[model samples]
Target: MRLLPAALSAAVLGAVLATGACGAASADPRVDAPVPAAQVAPAAQAAPAAPAAAQEVLPQRQAAAPPRPVSSGGASRAPVSDPGMDAAADGLRPFLLTPAEIGPEFTAGEEPRPDPATPAPCGGPGVVAQFPFAVRVGAAAESANGLVQETVSVYGDEAGAAEAYRASVAGMSCSEGRVDGRPAVIAPAEDLRADLGHDEATGWRIGGAGFDVVMISVREGEVVMNFTVLAAEDGLPALPDPLTVAKAGTQKLLG
Candidate 1:
C-alpha cells in the first residue's frame, strides 16, 4: 500500500482513542457516578380539573281554590224550613188579645133582605157581616162578599180551631186560599160559627152577590182568637194588602 499523508494518519489515530475512552467510561464502575435526587427529573404532577357547574332547580307550583255556585236571579236564597215562626209567636204574645176579652156571643150573619140599591156597612153593593172576635191584645172583624172570602172561628184549643176552619170552608162553594199569609182553605158563606174557625157557615142567605171569604183562628198564650174577611166577588185587586190590613187589625185587637 502507498504511504498515507501525515495529517490523515494523525486524525485516524485520535478518533480511535476517543472511541476507546467512551467505551471504557460506560463499562467501568470507577468512572461512572450515581444520579443525585436533585438532578433526576420528577414525575409530572396533574392539575385538579375545575369543579363541574352547579345545576339549578325550580320550585313546584300549587293548585288554586274552586269557585262558588250562583243562583239564576243572582240572589242568595233562604232554606225552605224556618224556625222563626215559633220564636215570633213566643215574643209577640204580649201584644195580642186574650181569649177572655173576646166575648162568646160574637156572631157572623147576613143582613136580612137589605135593599139591593142601598150600600152595606162595608160600603159594598151587598150587605155582609163583619164578625168580631177577641185576640191576645185587640179585636178584629171581617165582612163577606169579595173575589175570595174568609170566615174564622176560635175554639178552646188549636186542634179545635183548625178543625172548625177546615169544616166551614169545606161546606162552601169557594176553593182554598191562603189566610193570614199562611196556606188556608177559603169558602163562600153568609154566616160563620163563633167557635175556633167557623166564620163561613152553610145556608148563608145573602142578597144574590157572591163573596170570597178567609178564616183564621189562632191560640196564643191563654187566648183563642178568630179572624175572617169578606172580599168582593173579584179576587182582591190588592191581594196581600187587604190581607195585611185584616191581620194588622186582628193583632191590634188581640195584642
Candidate 2:
C-alpha cells in the first residue's frame, strides 16, 4: 500500500485575523497563508461568538480551523477500520492530537510534500513511513506563529523506531536549515525543556528571518512522533504551551 506523506490541505493557509485593524479584544496575533475560508470547519471550539456590539467595536479575527486528519494512502481524516490492520496496531490516527486537545486559535494547515532542500530531523536519503498520517495546525500558512505540526511513522519493530529517533536527532543538530520555505538556523532548544513522561526524546529550535519553530520528538515502541511548533510573522501568544502541548500529544499517541 502507498504511504500518504504529510499533507494538511484543509486549513494550511487559513488567514489569521488582522487584529489591530480588526480591533481584536484578545491580545493575540493572526495567520499566514489564509485558507480560502470556504473549507474551514465550524467554530464549535472557538470562543463564544462575541455580542454584536462587542464585535462591532473590535475587528473580527478569522474563524479558527482545526487541522485536517491524515492517514495512509491519503485516507480521510477520520481513521477507519482496516480489516488488514488490527486496532492495536493502528498508528496513524491515534498518534495525532485531537481537536479538543488543540483548542481554538489553530486551524488545519495545508502542508506540501517535503522539499529536498529541507533536511529531515531524522536524516536519510528520504523519509520512510510504513503507515503515515500527519496533522499541521497554525493561525496562518506563511506569516503567523505557533504553527503546530505532528507527523507519526510506525515501523514494524522497536529497533527501527529507535534508529529513526537517533538519526532524526543527529539530523536535527545541523547549524543551518530551512523551515516553511524560509532559511533558518538550527540549534538545541535548551530553554524549552521538559521531562516528557519518558525517554528517547529530543528538541530543536529552528530560527528563520520571518519565523521561528520549536521541534520535539519522542518514540514509543514502533512509533516515532515528531512535533514542530512555529512562530511566524504574528507571534506565539495565540497558541498554547509547546512543551505542554507536545506532552499531551505524546500521551495520546502512547495511550
Candidate 3:
C-alpha cells in the first residue's frame, strides 16, 4: 500500500513486481512456459520438408540496444535524478545491495533516473518527511525461494532514518491502507527477524484478499532496506522465510 510511503519500488517493483512469480506459484509453479515440459513430442508421421525457396536467410547484423539493468520482474527503472533524491542516493549508494547481492540470477533495472511519482511521504506523513531528501532504489528477482522484492529508502541522517523507520513499523496497525495504489488490509506475519547488529530490525506479513506479502526491514545508519516475499491467495503456500530475504539484504548492505 502507499502507506509503505517512500518505500515503493516501481509501484509493484516494491510490491506488484512479485506478482509474476507469485502468480506462478499460486497458480501452478509448473514449467508451463518451457514447451518441452507440457507439449507432447511430434506425432509419429513426419511432415514433408518445405521447398528450398521457402528458406530465408536471417539478419546477420543488427543495432544493439543499451543493456538493461535487469531482465525480468524488477521495474526498478527509476533512479535518483532530482537533487533531493540524488542527495539521498549519494549518501547511501555504497550500502545499496547490488543485483548480484540481491540474487545470483537477478538482473538490474535501468540506470538511475528520477522517480517523481514518489513524492512527500507521511507515516501519517512518514519516512521521507523527516529528511530534506531521501533516495529509493529497488530491484526484483525470481528464485526457488519465491517471488522476492527489495526497496530501500535513504534518509539524511540516522536520527531521521530511525524516526522514519519507527513510523513505518507503526503504520502496520492501520486496518486499511493503500498498497501500490489499491487499498489493502495489514497484518503481522509472526516470522523471523533480522539480527545482523543493525541498529534496528523488524518485519511484517501484510496483504489483503487476493495477495499476501511478508517483509523484513533493517536500518543501518541512514539506510532502511526491506526485503519482501509474497504470493497471491489462490494456491498460496504457507509464506516462506522472510528471514532469508531479510538476511540477504542485510548481508548485501553489510558486506
TM-score of each: 0.24, 0.53, 0.52
lDDT of 1 by residue, 1-255 (tens): 211101112233234333431211111000000000011111101111100110011011112111010000000011122244223333443333332232232232221111223222112221111111111111222222121112112223545434433433332333222111111222234332232222322222111011222333333332333333333223223233333433443445342
lDDT of 2 by residue, 1-255 (tens): 111112212132122221112221232111111001111122111221111212222112344321111111111121234443323334344445654567664454443232222224222322323223222211112213234555554545667556655555555555543332223345543422346755566665543333334556666666555565554323444456657776877666565
lDDT of 2: 0.38
Clashes of each: 49, 30, 16
Candidate 3 per-residue lDDT, tens place, 59-97, comes to 111221111110011112223337654444444445545
Q: 1 or 3, which is superior by lDDT?
A: 3
**Model 3 stretches with alpha carbons more than 4 Å out:** 1-126, 129-132, 143-146, 189-196, 234-240
lDDT for each candidate structure: 0.23, 0.38, 0.39
Q: Give the best candidate by lDDT.
A: 3
lDDT of 2 at 220: 62
Rate residue 122 of model 2 by lDDT.
23
Using TM-score as the measure, which candidate wins?
A: 2
